[model samples]
Target chain A: MTPSTDAPHSCTRSEDELWASLGSPPDAHELQCLTCQEQRRRLAPLAQAAQEWKTGTDPEESLLEGILGRVMHGIRTEIRRGTLFTLTVTPLGPLRISSYLLLEAIRDAVDSIEHVELRTHKIIPHADDAGPISLAVSLAMQAGQDGTEVAEETRRTIAARFAERIGMPIGTINVTVEDVFQ
Target chain B: MSGPEKPDQQQLGNLVARAQSGDPRAFEKILTYHQRGLLRFCTSMLVVPGDAEDVLQEVYLTAWRQLSTLHAPEALGTWLYRIARHRCIDHLRKRTPQPRDLQGPESLAGDIAASDDRSGENPESNAETNAAMTDLRRFVHELPANQRECWVLKEIHDLSYADISAIVSEPIATVRGRISRARTTLAERMRPWK
Candidate 1:
């Protein structure tokens, strides 16, 4: 593009051309021209301001912290959303619940059972094989409580809760009494 | 691209390594380090300060989830910037941004244009410079998207043309031309004040 044809006060060369030259070695005309010198002088403050602007306009600290907190919450939500299982009924509809939420429900059910402390639980879903979910739960029984009865009670409670809350039939509820609490 | 190691890059690389290894605090460090500049760039692109912060938060979230996928840790600044740029552009295209008119109190303008103390000027001259810088910043928000991006990335961040091109996904020649044109426009706009 040609420079503006405006006379002496302004450079005949376009700013684009002048800027392009600034990237390379100084031109002989640029060295001798008064207008080009003025252009350079004009650009200097802009460049300075640009550098200063980096540290100048910081967002409020609380805003940054709030954003970070939101982002972290979003990450957790995404993780929860990723592990969601879709349950299909005969003709009713499909429902979505996170595997984590399902596991928590199981833990709560088992813990509420007499003399049983739920340690951990895992839900295994075989969507490809169209198999029912397999739940394996570990629990600690009170020393006076019968292990067999408590294990049986834990299994029954988990199955009932899974059916009631998740609305999905379970293939098996494997309850293991790993520890006996005094 | 191998070169002498910059101190900041070295620090960033270490932080990125820790963040990739599941350190949330390290990730926060990375976020705080780049937030200011990214906010400026995004604010320029989206016009509204609030939108800019939202985009930056999204940028950091994406970065946190995808940190392991970033192959080159040394280019963390550019990578974060690239993400912010895309988010800002997407944000701009999706909806109308409320224009942030320069309506803040005149006394507060100097606070927003706090000097970096690099120029070693007296308080009076520095205040004047700060006021002028504030005006230039306002003019920047009024600039078209591409030119504003090119100018802010080049001037404020001191990114090389190559880096700016990669972040904005423009050719180096195009980046140069945009910056030059932007400077010309800015010169004409500021001429009256002089």
Candidate 2:
């Protein structure tokens, strides 16, 4: 007796095609094919192994912690080498602050505000070698806070902090609500 | 088991912007979030834990220095993966070509055993699972480097085909094909366990 061409045991799809098909909906040819079914059964363990590998915790968490510390140290040193801006002109010379310091000040100012978290900030110094600067900050507010009122308060708080802490006048303060957190 | 949840794109973008503007804390947050997946990719590609650790450190440092070069802040995840891929390739090139003595079979087995205990499986079943996992890791390690990288990025890291393509600098079709070839090889090799 000859085997029927459509028989489940007689399907001839390549293993590559079968594996690819597993990623998508089973085609009609795959629906009734014993060869495909067997292949899928054989492949199930491999898929499970891959999933386990993905979700497994690193065996050497201590090593990763060490690496993180070193990486952050390198980053902090590199940040200190970044561009500097003039905070004010003192009698000695220009009282310049590194970009890192400026960012820390802005972070501290925003941290003091209730319901407003600073996400990012850009400090734009006057191009003509002046003292006044523009500040652009993106903030995330606590859920249920009034956005307009919070934004206005943030702008005023940042300006005041810059004037009081850094002794520099802020020309314009732009506050954007980029996210809301519960 | 599932990995930690990734920050949404907007939050990640904000983190990237903050890092670019010299915020160490923000950059540290980004590093803490991605370090595990990046380390896994590097380990799979290099097949050695020490080399993977070194590559991961370089990847994060390079990312920090070049943060300003990344214009699309939302693409930070793929961008870091791309950096890791390049660094892994360079590390691989610097070393003499030879069969790597892959580490972690015993440790991985231990991990599996612990997981099995949590799931209330017997020691007999735990041993079988451990053996199967060890075999699968060896099979994955033996694949060609390109196929291994693409396969690890897609399967282990859960990256999309497009994201894998961008990291490996291959077209999406090529990424899919590489991943397909990898799956075929792994399935065939693990058929005995079934």
Best by TM-score: 2
Candidate 1, position B43, lDDT: 71
Model 1 ranges with Cα > 4 A deviation: A1-32, A55-62, A73-182, B1-18, B97-127
Distance from true location, Cα of A44 in model 1, Å: 4.5
lDDT of 1 by residue, A1-182 (tens): 22321322365676656554554656898889888877766555665555556656454434766777788777656656657666664466656567757765786686578776665467778666355678877776778998888888888888888788877778878878876766
- Model 2, B1-194: lDDT tens per residue? 23457787767776777777678898888888888888878878887669988998999888888888999976788999999989999998898865444553456455445434443322247667676676677778778888999988888887888888888898987887788778877876665555
When summed lDDT is taken over every stretch of 10 residues in candidate 2 chain B, the lowest stretch is: B115-124
Tally clashing residue pairs in candidate 1. 0
Model 1 in CAPRI terms: which quality? Answer: incorrect
Error of 1 at A136 (Å): 25
Best-fitting candidate, scored by lDDT: 2
Count of backbone clashes for each model? 0, 0
| Model 2 regions lying over 4 Å from their true place | A1-32, A87-95, A115-119, A126-133, A138-151, A168-182, B1-3, B98-124
